[model samples]
Target: MSDINIELLINTYLVPFGLKILMAIAVWIIGGMLINMIAKLSRKAMSIQKIEPTLAQYGESTVRVALRIALVMVILEVCGIQTTSFAALIAAGGVAIGMAWSGLLSNFAAGIFLVILRPFKVGDAICAAGQTGAVAEIGLFSTTLTTGDNVCVHVGNGKLFSDNIINYTTNPYRRVDLKCQIANGVNPQEAIARLKIHVAKIANLSKAAEPCIEILEFNASGIVIAVRPFCNNNDYWQVFFDTNKAIADTCAEAGWPVPAPHQIEFHKD
Candidate 1:
């Protein structure tokens, strides 16, 4: 082949290829910067609108990912690359990933629903999925809670959404349930009267609703008395513990038998 012909052939192949590669790189960088900027702006706007931080973060991440994917397709086209096979590959990959991570995706979707619905916010005490705690963080896949004892727990958003959520702090007050077992021989009316007196003296107890002392059940060991009083939800634990202790001490001082299971043995062989 002639040198000029060889030179022409090289130029024909290398020049366009080099130019297209440069264009692809430039597009990728610019597209990436634009996507990032847009995502940040979206997050700021959400924040200004008083959206939860967790929701804002999830929104920004999702927007950035979508933008990046679209930018990549544009970059490929700019580089003179046919995207038919590439698009098919991406679709197939996505399908496979979706199938493999269906559980996680479901949780993510549930988290988004939670963000929109606003069932419970951070710092709210809630009971769901048999776990009771204060909400610490809400993420794209899981919700974090800190228990009364300060143990941290992560619950999948799917599970949280599927189960019944009891928001304790949603209402102003909660009824504290207290159970006291007294000897069946003791006068039920007298025990109830004493309980009412003690409950009346409780400083922080809510008097909006009258306190109740009902003879709930007669068990093998004792007569089960149910004491229920209303109190602020924030004082639930305090009221519960205080009432139990006070009931025990008061019954003891009054010479009442605190019912407990007893065993008798007969020996004859």
Candidate 2:
């Protein structure tokens, strides 16, 4: 090749390629900044509309990802690189990933349903999947709960939705089911009357529903008393513990002893 031809090749080929590279980089940087700004705006808008924090965060992330993907395609086209093959490859990989992690994808989908449906909200006490707790957070894949005992648990949304959910805090009032045992010798009617008096004195107990006290069963141990009352959900534990203590104290004060398991002794001559 002639020296002049060599110089022409460097200017025409190498310089243009370098410029294209620079342009691609500049486009990526500018596009990335704009995408970030849009993501922030999306988050702010969702927040203003009172969307769940986890859902809003997931939305922002999804938007940022889509924007970056489009930016990559634009940059490739600007650099004279064909992206149809790239898009096809990405689609193929996505399908493979989806097939391989179908369970996880289902959980993600269920999480989205949970957010949109609002089956339960943050701070609500719920019983689902055999676990009872207050909802701490709802994530894209899992829902977090803080149990009454203060232990944290992460439950997949798929499992949560698959089972029945009991939202204890959905209503301001909750019906408490309590069972108390008294000495078999005690009169069932008398015991029930004593219980009603004690139940009335408990704080936060609802007066809308009259307390129910019934003699449920007679066992070898003692007569079983079933008590049903209404109270605020927030006062569930308090009312439960207090009512139990009061029943026990009242029985003791009345000279009634709770029955203990017994076995007959026999001797043969």
Candidate 3:
């Protein structure tokens, strides 16, 4: 009779418990695979629709996370755990969870706004959050930027969204502001003509907008000539340096005296 009772207990509880554990493991593995497949399909669909890269990536991540959470709940149910009770527990601790994840939540919200607003996109040259660089990636928590000096930086999305954003690549061309000082004795008209001629030969200069060479102002240091040139954003640095060299070369070639601050001395006898 004792042996029979032992067999019944094992069959009633142990066998079912073992089966439940195995099923839970299977569900977890299968659920994970499905989540990955859904994420991939979502990305492909977004790509086909010609969505922005940042938005597509963000959508994929969000879908993956939500699916993973659902998978966990399914696994808990398979293990004979009450998912409704678990959800209630989470709700009960909502205040504490919110406090602990306040920064992350803010960043996530900011990222959503960034995707919707479309202020800037991947590969755009932007200045935001005191960092100027090409946007490399937009993540839920932070934005990645590749600076001109080749350093990668990550700025929190919350900060980036709250700050002012300057997108340099939005315009057809950007103006390079440069100043060239000429001696007071030099002819401003002649200097302007020479500089313009020199600047015109620079490569990558915008043909639609001619180089604006004009006398800006005069101060302690002779006449300040504003050498403003328009060029595509990609070639801004190259054009900037080339224009500067052109100004120096033009002044030297013209045998113009170097600009110097003038001071008058009154002598008492």
Candidate 4:
């Protein structure tokens, strides 16, 4: 190439454009490091505030992704690219992504609300999204539950939020309701007194609260006795099982039997 043409090439394209390219590269490298530092500090601050671990992780990831995206735009501008066109392209891409992941976005939003509202937390035994289990992990998209049978269940946050959430651990105390059907001939007063005594013997029952044992409704089969026993939340299931077993044993031992269904048969000619 001629000396004049070589000079023009270096001056017009190589020098200035190359410098901008180098600057953009530098910005990308430095920007990444700064973003990382910011994310680290944000996590530390969240931890100091005792934020939920799942929330903290999601927050850090979201912030980091946003910062990286912003940094890329700045780098593109520095490289003499039209930022307006890039922004338009980003908007289009974002809309497509949003449409594609609408369900995921909804779950993400629901997860954020869950983290903030805290209807239930890790280790809480709850009934949500039509499943009963103890929460193992709360994630951005879904929650993990360890069921009573030790099965791991993944329930979407959107569904969990939309449905009824029965948190067994919300209150310190929970009531154990036991329905006992006794024979018609058994003395109601004696049965109630015996049931109350049996309930009081159950483990983890609150001594402060008196159990309400009474005959609620009677049918042709038997008398329906409502046994309400209050116990700590952690010991709810234990009390429930124990009370049921105690009731059956007590009735059997006292000869106050639960009557068999009286079915009548007619002879046909």
Candidate 5:
């Protein structure tokens, strides 16, 4: 190539592209650092306020991601890319993606609603989507729950929003309904009376409401004795497990045996 042509090319294209590339790199580096700082600060602030951890973390991460995307667009413009055309293409892609994944987008929208409405928070035991469990995490698309048996469940936010959500830990107190099956060996009335007394004496039980014991139904096996006890949410699991164990032990030690299965006999002519 000629000397003059080489010089013209460097001035017209090479130098301009190089400068823009350098500028774009600078923006990417600086923008990433700023986004991180903002997220950290927001999280720290929420922590100081004692806000729910799930909400705080989610908010921080979302904001950081949004800012990073904007920064990327700006960097592309600086690199001599046509930002208007790029933006139009992005919009078109987003529309296609949204259409292709409509259900996922619905779940994402429902997740935002869940976070805003604050129906249930993290660590609360809730019944939703035909499953009952303590909420482990609330994500952008699904809510995670840990069941009684330690199973991790991920429920779509769209379903959770549409269905009824029963939050057990919302109030300070929760009612524990325990059923004791009547056996042929044990006296139903006497057993119910004893259970009522035991429930009242148990630790952490709310004294505000008196425990009630009654006969619910009589099945083929035996009668069902219902024991309703109220306790603090913090002590819910403890009270439940302890009461079940205590009642069984008490009945066994006292020789109050459950009856055998009832069977109907038919006579043939």
Candidate 6:
């Protein structure tokens, strides 16, 4: 090929193409960094305004996704692609896209409702869709939870919103229910009295509510005494374990016999 023809080819196609590619990469990197900064600033602003953390996080995530989408369109425009035409194409296929992404749309809707309803918030310990944990984040499509075992779980908002939600952290305090089984010979009234004293001494027990100790029922094993203590949600587990220990210690100190099942034998001829 002639040098003139080669120079024309390089200038006309290669140079422009290379420049477009570089521009696209620059836009992508810079756009991403800017989006992150904006999101961070927005979150900080929300914090300053005392906005709810759950809503703040969800807003940040949604804004970031939207900005990223716009950035992609800008990059496409830089690459000699017409974003207007692309948008038009998407609009033309909106029905098909909506049908294909029905579940995602439903999840998004459910997430909005979750935020609006404020059933549970970030850091709340809730059981939803059979998963119990502290809510880490409420996203557009799902909610993140950190379980007692420290497992991170992401549950679909649709499923979580549709199912029963038990928000343990909503109330000021929760009741810790424990059962004590005493041998038939042990006096139920004495056992109940002892339990009340020990359970009252448990650390973090709620001062707002007194411990309730009463005979629950008579079981095959023995007389079942219900030991109920109230404590803040944050101290629930501690109070629970401590209450159990209190019951055991009370039984041992009283020298009560171990509860065992009793059965009557009969012979029919």
Candidate 5 residue pairs in backbone clash: 183-259, 184-259
The RMSD of every model to the true structure, in order and in angstroms, is: 5.3, 4.8, 3.3, 5.6, 3.8, 1.9
**Per-residue lDDT tens digits of candidate 3, residues 119-215?**
9999899999999999999887899999999999999999999999999999899999999999878889999999989999999998879889998
Q: What TM-score does each of the candidates earn?
A: 0.71, 0.73, 0.87, 0.71, 0.77, 0.92
lDDT of 4 by residue, 1-269 (tens): 99999999999999998899889989999999999999999999999999977678768877887899899889988988998998788787997878889999899899889988989888889998889999988876889999999999999999999999999988878888879888878888988988877878888887768788998998877788998889987788899999999888779878976566555699999
Residue 264 accuracy (lDDT) in model 5:
82
Ranking of predictions according to lDDT: 6, 3, 4, 1, 2, 5
The collision pairs in model 3 are: none
TM-score of 4: 0.71
Residues 1-269 of candidate 5 have per-residue lDDT tens digits of 99999999999999999898889888989998999998899999999998888899678868887898899888987887888998788787997877889999899899999999989998999999998999998888899999989999999999999999999888878888888786865687788877776766678888777776889988878888877788987788888887787678667766776666888899999
The alpha-carbon deviation from the true structure for residue 236 of candidate 2, after best TM-score superposition, in angstroms, is 1.1
Off by over 4 Å in 3: 1-26
Give the winner by TM-score: 4 or 5: 5
Cα-lDDT of candidate 2: 0.85
TM-score of 1: 0.71
Specify the poorest-scoring 10-residue window by lDDT in model 1. 256-265
Best by TM-score: 6
lDDT for position 37 in model 4: 100
The lDDT per prediction is 0.86, 0.85, 0.94, 0.88, 0.85, 0.94
Off by over 4 Å in 2: 1-40, 50-83, 92-95, 261-269
Q: Is candidate 2 or candidate 4 better by lDDT?
A: 4
